[model samples]
Target: MPRRHVKLHARPPQEVQGEAVDVLVRRGLDDLRRELDVPPSFPPDVLAEAADVVRRGPSGSRVDATDVPFVTIDPEGSKDLDQAVHIGRLGDGFRVQYAIADVAAWVQAGGAIDDEARRRVETLYAPDGRTPLHPPSLSEGAASLLPDQVAPALLWTIDLDAAGAPVQVGVHRASVRSRSQLTYTGAQAAIDDGSAGETLQLLREVGLLRQAAERARGGITLPTPEQVVEQGADGVWTLGSRATLPVEEWNAQISLLTGMCAARLMLDGKVGILRTLPDADPRDVQRLRLSAHALGVPWPDGATPGDVIRDLDAANPRHAALLTDATSLLRGAAYVAFDGELPAFTMHAAIAAPYAHTTAPLRRLVDRFVGETCLALSAGTPVPDWVRDALPELPGLMSAGDKHAAELERGCLDLVEAALLTGREGQVFEGAIVDVRADRDEGVVQLRDPAVRGRIEGAGLPLGEDVRVRVVEASVPQRTVRFALADDQADSASA
Candidate 1:
């Protein structure tokens, strides 16, 4: 991956003119309030009451969690801890001990908490903070995999062979005692410094092997920049890059592996929604191929586009650029639910597998239903009526949540970037060429450092990743930052 550099100059926050951030906020709040019908309070008793109801439900099996060495890996200060994983060597493969918080264990079928959870549908993240799907008292406290706390969970042990293929999977309900709470950054640092504990080392190893396997399977590895907004002492918003460590990616890979297995089961039974995206169109592939060739990147002949992507992403900066640029081709995602048989297009282009959202039940409502169903099926228990009822509505609800969340996150980013750029209006700053449009009328120039991009002139200038440019204008009110040629106007005229 290409390294990103930053040039920082300290300055106070300025009022961004022209943009109505309040309108965006209002719209976001309205979506949460009106569309989701989010509950007003984060009460502890709600979860406790729900758990009591589930406890009384008829089931021949028992669930516990106090013995398993489950641990959570999330961002520092994250309240809604969703998952805890443990991995170890098993034969020539590895045993992945993943403990996902059992939201279904607590939230009763057709209860108030369940209704509220369904209403929220998904968690909302804003510049200020997050509106968690579950109350903090349960999500952050009781059910969370806090150190030494025994919590009810759905435990999955997946055995992956040395080649990183999952050979076997075991699912059960249990009470787990988390040894400690680990942050992704902390775990990554330990792996880097070679002083990581046994558990963390296993995590790093598993993640590495899984990543290698995915690459071998022709999965697209794109370098996409993520923006995070942090509040300052003066209540000003500042933009920062969100670093995704190898371990984080690996952790996600494990989640994908589990979801894929669950999806396979659902499909074999010929029912349930699977997260699906069609393979890239041939024209898009051709365009990508030509672009890579134009950039002097190696495009492997006689191989699939995925093969070209893998080889290029591994070769040169041009190839890396090519890989990232192809991200826009993957779109028009659909929630596929069928009973007769699985559809031909159930594959997710990114992971190269049929997958579903099944692991993050605490954070996502759809996951709760899917997770519960998976658990019941795995345990040979009858699928709950509420879960059966929930399966159909989840596709639409989750998709709507995805749209709403994306808008809020992107909107907040625009506002913050606009606010940050106000401090440097008419000031020249270095940037990279992220994208170019054939129309010339529509183009975005992304910066490499201080990393903000914008629509800019593109008549003759080549727009490729990491190509340098300069900021020409910054508007907070308009929620836009403009760029121009970095060289002197005299030099430009002479040229």
Candidate 2:
């Protein structure tokens, strides 16, 4: 397994001083698309076929489960709803029914929609918009698990014992109607104000149980604050960091639970695609310990990396920097597809579990096939020929999409930061030294006020210490920002 370096997004700057950032980000995104050869739109025939599929509606055999009060929880304005969940207490245990969009039901094998989806692999997101893998008519319309609308879904009914570990897992195709569409904020408020209905409350309970189980299994959870681009009242784009809500984690646990169950199914059934990550290198862990010491974060004696990381505060700049640098430990994530023999490696290091992605078929390409595999295995039927043939090709296709997604995210952030600091070159700003190069000639500094991260050319700068820096360059076209230590700060460091 190869190592994968995952970069964390910084919080938005306090104030953005310049023109609206939307135009610049839009242009940069277009350039990135061209450079990556990302498909601009679905082929016209694919769209027409999607429309025809929508009219034809769900076909073949499926269990009717519209009575289940499943609900969707996503970002405030998300249209491409993927998974809807229903939870209930069963005696001393729990039952979770997760419904994933039945994309395979609508997309025929080797058809126009299927061909285009195979090419795109996954949805590519930008600040201004997104390039979807499937036509919106299916991804967001007929196939989406919107409220009160019956839609085709791959349903997973998982029975968990009191310890939150799955005791039984069942998967099948079904017609499901979401009772309502809820957002993270709304769900959190409901949980806080005692307005949360039975399902939401049960979801919280099961989510926490699963979270505890994850930790007990030595899983690593990094509560890194997200840098988000938002529009102000005047329509100017600004970057800011948003803290992850408890509800978000709780909701995510449901997905993780389903994924783990799916992985076990595949391992037992002898064929499927899995999201796998190798364990962190011992050298990386030692380096992280040294970093924690320098950053004044406590890594108590005999503590595992996961234990120490689970307690860090995301709001603290030093801790955030440590998390950013910790990306070095979480590399080599890849999709492994198998037919008869199980892959030599099966566990995802971060999750500390054998995991398969079966919950977000609408957004991801591999999940579609994983869902199909689970359904077939549960029914004691053979895996579809299309899905079996696709196993070998999915890893490469998904890898390409992963690279494009990362580039789009990081590139947009770089463009926004450069735009925000265009006229502020040569101005001194306070920042923290988040990272240092081995050569000691330069390091990565994160500005305190504007929340901009850029390279600084300075020697002997202490990691995790604050210093005054002068912005030497900011170029929007190149999406680069360079800084140098202020005169007094440089002199003091040298001394």
Candidate 3:
């Protein structure tokens, strides 16, 4: 792993003219859909089932929890709400009432909807739109825990001590209502201005405690800034980076807390799926240390990789490059399933604990099954026959969906980069070499402006060093960008 130069700014509006990047994006989306074999729409049977369920409303026995004033926090404009929370301080601990959308209640086992969800595995997201795992009639309307709507849910009541360690856990089918739908930004604003209601204020306190506990467990949290593409009112697309927000992390802690509880239940019951990742390889860690040294970043003695990474500034290009290189240490993530015996490896290295996906069933397929398993175990009943039969096949199905999702995300980014740099060929820009082919004369370089990454054609390009390079080509149809070191600079370095 090596550090590469990356550009970090969006082009000014005056400079971006004539070309319709949105049209190019649409074309790219079509290309990706064809290449990836994305489904056009839900099967007729699945849609019909969804419509029927929507008309019928929630069925089966459920405990009424509509008295709890829970609120959902997600990104702005999100509709497929999955989870809601209400936190309160008890005598010496905290009580967390987390209500997750009970999607399985609406989708019967071996039914048309279930069959379609198995094939889809998970929702696929793109900048333009999303290919939802379940039909919108169910995922967005009926199953969603929208504000003021009573939805069937799997309610988890977790009691935690002052140190944020779980002292008790309970899960059951319940009908719940959310009092409000809050965005991450809105919740954060309330906390900062001291205008937050009792539940939100308690959320901040419990969230901080949980985060501190995670850090104490040696969990790794990468500070990678997200590269976002936004279309203006005038319909011009611009690319920029957004730092992770505090409220986002705090909200995620609640989800993580629930996931950990789910994992514990499955492990204790000796049956379920676990999200596992091997510990960072020693060799990869050594290489990352070398990379850090090359980038002039410090790795204090006796510091764990997570300790060092957690403190790096995301704004630093070198730190960003280091984080990109650290991807090697995070390989081999998988879903492990078992019925009668426990898996030898159970920990998710990033979390430094056993974890499972039992939340976000509205967006993810596995959560629905995991939630069912946890519910059955909590109720002291036998695991459902359908869930038990599907355990072994889940790993492969989820892996395929994960691959498709990663490719779609990367492909979209590549397409946007090509469209944005379409007419800027041959312009020299400052960049750093992030990676090099062992047996070739080319290496990957990241530019500083527009924050584009592409291959540079040059012999002996210094790894982890800043250099000037000219954009050799930008091809929108091929979705490719290539660069070459400036002639004088190459000659000088050779001299």
lDDT against the true structure, per candidate, is 0.68, 0.86, 0.86
- On TM-score, the candidate that comes out on top is 2
Model 3, runs deviating above 4 Å: 1-19, 430-432, 436-441, 459-467, 487-495
lDDT of 1 by residue, 1-495 (tens): 432323333345454455343444334444444443444465566667645654564233446656656677888878677788787788887888888887776676787777777777778877666778877666677767678876777888788888778888778887777887888878878788999776678776777777777777667656543666666565544566554667777778888889988887677666667888777787888888788778876766676666666444322345445755788678778777654666777888777888888888878888877777777677667777777777778888888888877866766666556556654656766555556665764456655445565677645555454444556666544556777666663255237
lDDT of 3 at 457: 81
Model 1: weakest 10-residue lDDT segment is: 1-10
Tens-place lDDT per residue, model 2, 74-173, is 9998989999999999889999999999999899989999889888888887777888889999888998999999999999999999988899999998
Q: Any idea what lDDT model 2 has?
A: 0.86
Clashing pairs in 2: 2-332, 3-332, 4-331, 4-332, 12-239, 12-240, 12-241, 13-450
RMSD of 3: 3.1
lDDT score at residue 208, model 1, on the 0-100 scale:
74
lDDT of 3 by residue, 53-163 (tens): 889877789999999999999888889999999998877999999999999889988999999988888898877788999999988888999999999999999999988
List candidate 2 segments past 4 Å from native: 1-22, 438-440
What's the candidate order when arranged by decreasing lDDT? 3, 2, 1
Deviation (Å) of 176 in candidate 2: 0.5
